[model samples]
Target: MNRPAALAVLLLLAVSAGCTDTGPERTTLMVIPAGSLLYPLEDIEAAFESQHPDIDVRIEGHGSIQAIRQVTDLRREVDVVAVADASLIPDMMYRPMPEGDGNYTDWYIAFAENEVVIAYTGKSIGADEITQDNWYRILSRPDVRVGFSNPMLDACGYRALMVTALAEEYCEEPGLFEAIIGGSFDPPLQVDRTDGVAEITLPELMRPAGDKVAIRDGSIYLLSLLDAGGIDYAFEYRSVAEDHGLLWIDLPPEINLGFAEHADDYQKVHVTLGFRRFQSIGSERIGLPIVYAMTIPADAPHPDEARMFVDFVLECFQDGWPKSGTATVADKQIFR
Candidate 1:
């Protein structure tokens, strides 16, 4: 009606229009993950974003320990952390998140599963002669090289050592690890003895045998190595080997540590490490069914969106990856 009132209404309408056109910005997510899960997570990311077009998902892969460190030590910004070792979240981060989040990380969800395997090409030294029975002896050959992950860095590396130790007992051989791993490993840092156990010392470097042993951060990091013939054999997860089309020798559950029933027996062999130099995780390493863990930290950038991504991952794992014209459940077939 009046000129002043008309002008006020017009200004209000313009401001409202600006707000409506912009809407709220899409949420950006950052996921720090264990290296082994890189490829699969890439698949999950694509599918996740397709399902939630408004959200943007990005991932950074590293050793599970390093993933934790990005939050704990390095102080990098991460919305969600998914680890190969579930215990790390509780052991490392439970104390630091926001209040009411006790001394240990409480919201951990374990999904899927895997067992250890020795994957090799047909050209691998003594590949044919190697069996579940004589495998350790074959890998130990002075001429044969072995590959493993860094125990202090990756779970698979530490698991490899534990599995080798278990194989010693299961095979009824006393000096198996020494004869096999000791020859190629950088020990005295972690010494191999005639006794069933080998002493593991930090700051020690294990070298490869010419071109035989090859070490990588995550088991999946060896895919290119295997393809390029950089190394003869590697210690990897059964699921990874299957995912990459590599032939793998399945160790028995007694040694594979995939079965829950053998938890006590599997716990026999352990590896200790000086994590922060102030404390040591003594005798903590053990071979167990590989169950990856996931959680959102208290300081996440987009926590609500991160939770949604994690939920989608769990759903994909349970429902299995979608394929051409069918819904296929992995049912351990992913590792077959």
Candidate 2:
């Protein structure tokens, strides 16, 4: 064999090898979750990915309602959805969906619990003196600014209002609810006492008229503003407050939406989202134990991977929740 013949043969062999060496394609799993679960999910994603290197997990955080709507309404691709409110999974995504081909999800597992509270920084007005008993009063001051998520969009928003209504009864303050939330949003919210429960009727448009209430799309969005003094205090999840290192006032069990034992009391204050997403078929979100739920959508692109991930998350919550500022041991995590 001559040198030229040998060179041509070698080149041909290299090209053949390159064409035959097809490596495995990486599988991508898309997860849309509540902003409140961002940190914990990040940890979960890291751990899950380490154990399963072939799978690539991508996550986006939004309000729980908005998160579900991304798949059901916006037609975005998602494999898994984890929401702060478990009921949202059924109420917003269940049967009679926008697609009309049955529900977006048939079931979900409730895996974690959180509490609602008033979170603030040292720079906040009356931060040195504000206590669980005095948070509402401090919020009502003429110069103080408060922040909360949009009820039309985020669970925390409506939960904030529920906490206020509950506070009114617990403190024996007749007009406390009106003083804080009413003065914040435009066309003041109306209170309809039905069967001893104060059902708050929210306006179709959530327009924040004055600077009194800094309303954002999600609760996590307010953390930066709170830290920068753009707003004094924000209504946020207890996990969020703890994770962000903010000074928070823990509301009573009845108002915090934390204790499952107080679910009946928590149900007394509900908020109706009559926004466009509801489209006249509004979901009257009654308070319940602050449970987080996750489900692989019926139309998921990667149901198997999603199921595996959900299982991993449940196990993580059972073993790692306390360190993550989440509660799961004391019947806090009701696995469904």
Candidate 3:
């Protein structure tokens, strides 16, 4: 151990430490996805961050509409947006930005599909008795508490309304929507039928008349309530129920909004959002097969990083996440 060699080693260590301390900062990619995507995306985020150590991924979940409103209305600068409804990207984000020359987003990729279901627990009232044949009747009982997301915010919320309305035709039981949902609201969520179509309008503010119905901002939030015995049943996505390991009964294909072949049948029911703010964007949400989509906003602060993350997410889906029943990959096409 010579003195000159020791001095050289100390100087080299100091330079190495200086270089490590001044490395480039990681880029933050902000993602706002549908509430239903929170769990899966958390897994995706872990994998993505592991592969790209220089990028930090942050995800926030909201009801599909609220997720878009966070950008389009609230003007939050987000890097990526993924929603349960593919049409919403065009429906809400295709318009011109308030302060920008271009629309919030010009395009998005439809990547996944989901279906609605009635989720319950073993502790749920009449859980042992509820079946596909008479689940609605069980939910309509006076002592049962039914929960759903806000129709004004979540895609699952409006789909719940559609499922019940469509059930009338599927089950040949008239007024089922009123029995399970409409009559439970304070102002009475009513249905207007015309030209072979059933339309339900939701007020700007919806409050349950009593304990019969519980409403949350997002469908995923109802999972906690269902677990805590706060609500006996909840209208949830099949994926959410399966993801959380809850018991859920599959509704008829005609009303589940899962099959693309049943798209025409699903269209018989429509939900109109009556909020004043929605008027500018058009509030009528026509029924369609549930499809999930994602996009990087035009004003995204980290478009390059967002694109890479989107690619990674799509790859994960293609690898077989749909097999879990969360959602089926819509198409095999990759984002370019």
Candidate 4:
């Protein structure tokens, strides 16, 4: 081979190696969202990535509390944080960072809403006979197994406790909470009443006394248990149940925590986390209408990308891009 031809061949090999090493430069945007948002966010991620080939969106799902803690407590370099409960942003993230100059997050937008429901499969113990009106009674059966997320970790877990307590008054059935939930734990989840308000105290470790109750880190984890027939029924978000195509009995507006008009009624129940980690923030969690929210952390590594992603999500909600089955988008006015 001639010298010029040999040099050309060597140059081509070097160029090909460079191209393979760096074909496209992509900026990664890290997102931590509540477990319930996993499916919908996956759809969003696909659409967003297609539109912005230069940006890669990475998502990790955890219980809303743990999702925020990944930033505020663990000091992870998360760009965006979303949660199932709107109040958690202020309750857990509004405080000043342990080593930073500002709060973990300064602002959050409430984007969607959801309701708690009992999800079960054909194999559920009372699947043939359970109804919204008698769900608590059915769950109380000694032979039945019930599942919920850990209250100290997931918003839905605490909401499940609240719903059961509220059902007593709404269904005119006394001791329903105790019959189904309270009495199933080892130390027992205890409830105290003052006037019309019911405050439920959760033990640090909510251990099930027997095979009657199953608890996981996030509500989404319960879906697999329901599918495997590990639990007769599971308390899940209506959006999650619908997304997974599971059968669910919708509770009344007052107990479902989905209706803003029932906000005052929902406020009658509260959950107090007994974990020492929550002592700094005051562990009491008041029941409110379920609202989904998101924010960019103050110390986010990719602030510009985080803002763009948040705007994209809000626009999707406004345009009904998440679809109806995942969760109900908040009013269009809120997005404006």
Compare the candidates by TM-score and give the number of the best one. Answer: 3
Q: Name the regions of candidate 1 deviating beyond 4 angstroms.
A: 1-24, 97-104, 185-203, 208-212, 217-221, 274-284, 319-336
lDDT by residue (79-181, candidate 2, tens digit) is 9999988887777677655667777878888877888889999999999989977887898886888888888778888899888889888888888877877
Ranking by lDDT: 3, 4, 2, 1
Q: Which window of 10 residues has the lowest lDDT sum in candidate 2?
A: 1-10
Which one wins on lDDT? Answer: 3
> What's the C-alpha lDDT at position 173 in model 2?
83
**What digit string (tens of lDDT, one per residue) describes model 3 on residues 190-213?**
888899999998987878888888
Model 4 alpha-carbon miss at residue 262, Å:
1.1
- Candidate 1 per-residue lDDT over residues 105-220, each given as its tens digit: 45677655567889888877787788877787787777776777767667888788778778877888877776766445443223344344444444445444455456776565
Off by over 4 Å in 4: 1-23, 97-101, 278-280, 319-336
Estimated TM-score per prediction? 0.77, 0.83, 0.86, 0.85
- Model 1: ten consecutive residues of lowest lDDT: 320-329
Cand. 4 Cα-lDDT: 0.79
Model 4: per-residue Cα lDDT over 1-336, one tens digit each: 222333344344334434333338899999999888887776567656655667789999887878888887688999999888888888888788888578887678887778888999999999999997678889989899999988877788889999988988888877778788888877777678899998998887788888888999876679889888899899888878877889998888889888778889999999988675544356788999888889888899999988878876765555332234233545533221
- Candidate 3 residues lying further than 4 Å off, grouped into runs, are 1-24, 98-101, 278-280, 319-336
- Better candidate by lDDT, 3 or 4: 3
Worst 10-residue lDDT window, candidate 4? 319-328
